[model samples]
Target: MGIIKKIFNKSRSPEDGIFFEEMRKILGFNPVDLSHYRKGFTHRSSNKTDENGNPINYERLEFLGDAMLGSVIAAHLFKEVPTGDEGYLTKMRSKIVSREHLNELGRDLNLIKWVESKVSAQHFGENIHGNLFEAFVGAIYLDRGFTYCEKFINKKVIVPYVDIPKLEGKVISYKSLVIEWCQKEKKQFHYDVFEDNGNEDVKHFGVRLKIDGKIVAKARATSKKKAEEKASQRAYFAFQEKINKK
Candidate 1:
């Protein structure tokens, strides 16, 4: 039986064996469905499809992983912060699963090294890390079920970083903070966003944050939302003393 098992293992592809070992090291367990994980790391640009003609990529898995992360975080927050109202718990959960936090987790795990993409990895944006992380979570959930999914998230996310006190003070959205401060101060504020005619492959949006008809901050990013947020963040720092007093 031992010899037979050894021979069976020898018949497996070397690349698959290495991938399985690496996945075991990262996931803390052997994966049942390696295909799911492969799909998780697959970029849509690869243009892969299953036998039935359905697309095979990480996007669907990313969606599932997002939901799973939210569910686990929400449950944990509900139990840990019994005094927290629904609004408070929801906000806390959002902070835990924010894109920034997710990107950090993915980068720490070095998940991008395993991604299968037609485009160069360097060309991919920052959000790719977070997207792959979510897809990996979805693959885990699909391969091992909810219990394993919860364990994985707890080990990687909650146990290491979900400190209630720290999270309470964490700023998930600088844009929201600036908007709230403006409303409280009864100051008129607006984000004037426009397409930036930059010589780049990707389109960029430029944003000028106006507070009381004065341009307080200007910033640019790949998206209008990001541009506005960047401008808002700069504005917050510029007016930190005044805003914090409120």
Candidate 2:
């Protein structure tokens, strides 16, 4: 048998009673159709196709969950912050649905314990937590419909974590702030990123944030996006006083 098939078999071998009970506790209600919930936790690596030969995994569900999260959060923000303009509302929504926030939520729920993947958990990046959380939301939407979906989100996300005052000050992306600052001030900026893998076991990327040909900050991380963001953070601090004054 294929390695993926073997992994799928192992993943499916868990007791339905135990899994259902665990899901019930997390869901705060009994699930109707268990298959949708199962699909939410299923990873693409399982190589399991449905009776219709459709690829079964959490990815498509993730898309739905993302949209659901945005809309729900947007509505809450709209009702809560009536004075907030479009840009303010948009920024607030971004902060609330930020990947970091979602990852934190997933961790709080201990959602990763149920994932079925051929790849080991440790091998999975931090984003896996957020992705699983989203897929789970999608599953809730599918299994119970939008009313239940909204309730679950409110219970898990809004009531516990949504603090309007706190979210307003949160910076989802320092890189975005830095870029916006540069453009508003009509300054030329660049992120010179390159592979920084050396003798280390893991690959890395290095970035230098330059403003008008002057290196303002430098950073290195596992990915180019992270490296640039880190460098931008440093640069933001370097110009914090000036940026803030503007």
Candidate 3:
């Protein structure tokens, strides 16, 4: 009986056994160090700390992961679009790693379901999905090195969604595009932004986009930047023909 109990003890650890299986499904391979992956899902609200009193959360890992993703994407773009200039390559990479795209990827993987947080997940902002996704990438790099990191990204990100021709016309930032077009066409453009507090829980900002001293578009959003972008997008559509000609 003692020998039987000893054999049972040597089997899968109860603490991380199920988690290991779930991670295997996501990663397509068994992870050697589960701690890294745990950290990837840890939230700052947990108030965890390392032995050295440093904060133990996914923020640092998110930074590393962002860099890794960018590097890998840049490399792939470089090889795939040999004729693409530096500016063109940069724009393509930005579209691939945009916050919106990252959020979509995270939601598709349902990564937020694994987060260990003291706060309720509903209280978390939309960016949490993208942040967790980046931290996961960071953890993969630390656990299995660059080769595996590249493989995972290529399988999950590049192969599935990165279509060069489609991405070439993708507008990651309408605000930037509008500004570029205005500069090239020598048009005088101004964004008249003001606080537009209404009967809402959150304060909002309104923006009126004027091109060549004429009101092209007006919009309101929760923040100034968002309001400006919203106005710019409307303005872009309004002047799409002229802008496209340029």
Candidate 4:
């Protein structure tokens, strides 16, 4: 048996779960309530519920985590960039808390292995990483409260991942930038997005960018935001010369 096989072949025992061990190692502390972490990793497809029959999954935790992450990032940015105005600080916070970066962080930590889900990993979309990361953050907040949450962010996120200069140049939403530029340039633009139900297992959306009533670009992605961004990118390239001239 090879290393990969050996790793996967480990018995998933109830008493000594390898995943829980890994979680403890990653978290640097033993979890007070394993159920919190369990729910943190759970996907809504599992159809789980608490004693009161309320849905018990990471979605609610993800919501909580998102707010916490934002608060932490905002606090850090505020102190780090004391001279930064609201727009600058807001942009920095956005860059730090962006879904793409959060997804990268979560994936690097391999948070998916703990998830309890009926769906296959192959079936899940990329956003799962970021969402799961946020869910885990929420779990930490609930389990350990604000102090530990702040410590974790500082140690795991701020110390390693955040750099002021790099964050300043980071683009959280290229689509937003393109739209802003279009509006400022007095150019007429429209995005026509429609659901595309094709042979793929997941539903997708197709987007076309119309500039001055002419089709400038088109794109398709798993979600509307993705499709819009892709269309915006294509539109940006198509109108690059014209937009840059102004």
Candidate 1 stretches with Cα past 4 Å from truth are 1-11, 170-246
For model 1, the local distance difference test gives 0.86
Per residue, candidate 4 scores C-alpha lDDT tens digits across 1-246 of 353454466555675475557667778765555667888988989998888999988999999999888899889888888899999988888888888999977875678877889999999899999999999999999977887788888877897578675467655665886779878988888889999967544567999888778888899876798788778766665676776888
Task: List model 2 lDDT by residue over 124-225, tens digit each.
Answer: 889988999999999988877888888899998997668665567666778899899899989999999999886543568999989999999999876798
Local error of candidate 3 at residue 109 (angstroms): 0.5
lDDT of 4 at 75: 91
Candidate 2, number of clashes: 0
Q: Rate the local accuracy (lDDT) of all candidates.
A: 0.86, 0.83, 0.86, 0.80
- State the lDDT of candidate 3 residue by residue for 1-246, as single tens digits: 653454345556766888877888778776767889999999999999999999989999999999999999999999999999999999999999999999877875778989999999999999998999999999999988888889889987897568675587777777998899999999999999999876543567999999999999999876798789878877877787776889
lDDT of 1 at 185: 90
lDDT digits (tens) for residues 1-246 of candidate 1: 653454356655789888888888889876776888999999999999999999999999999999999999999999999999999998999889999999978876779988898999888999998999999999999988898899999998897668676578777777999899889999999899999956544567999999999999999876788788778877877787776889
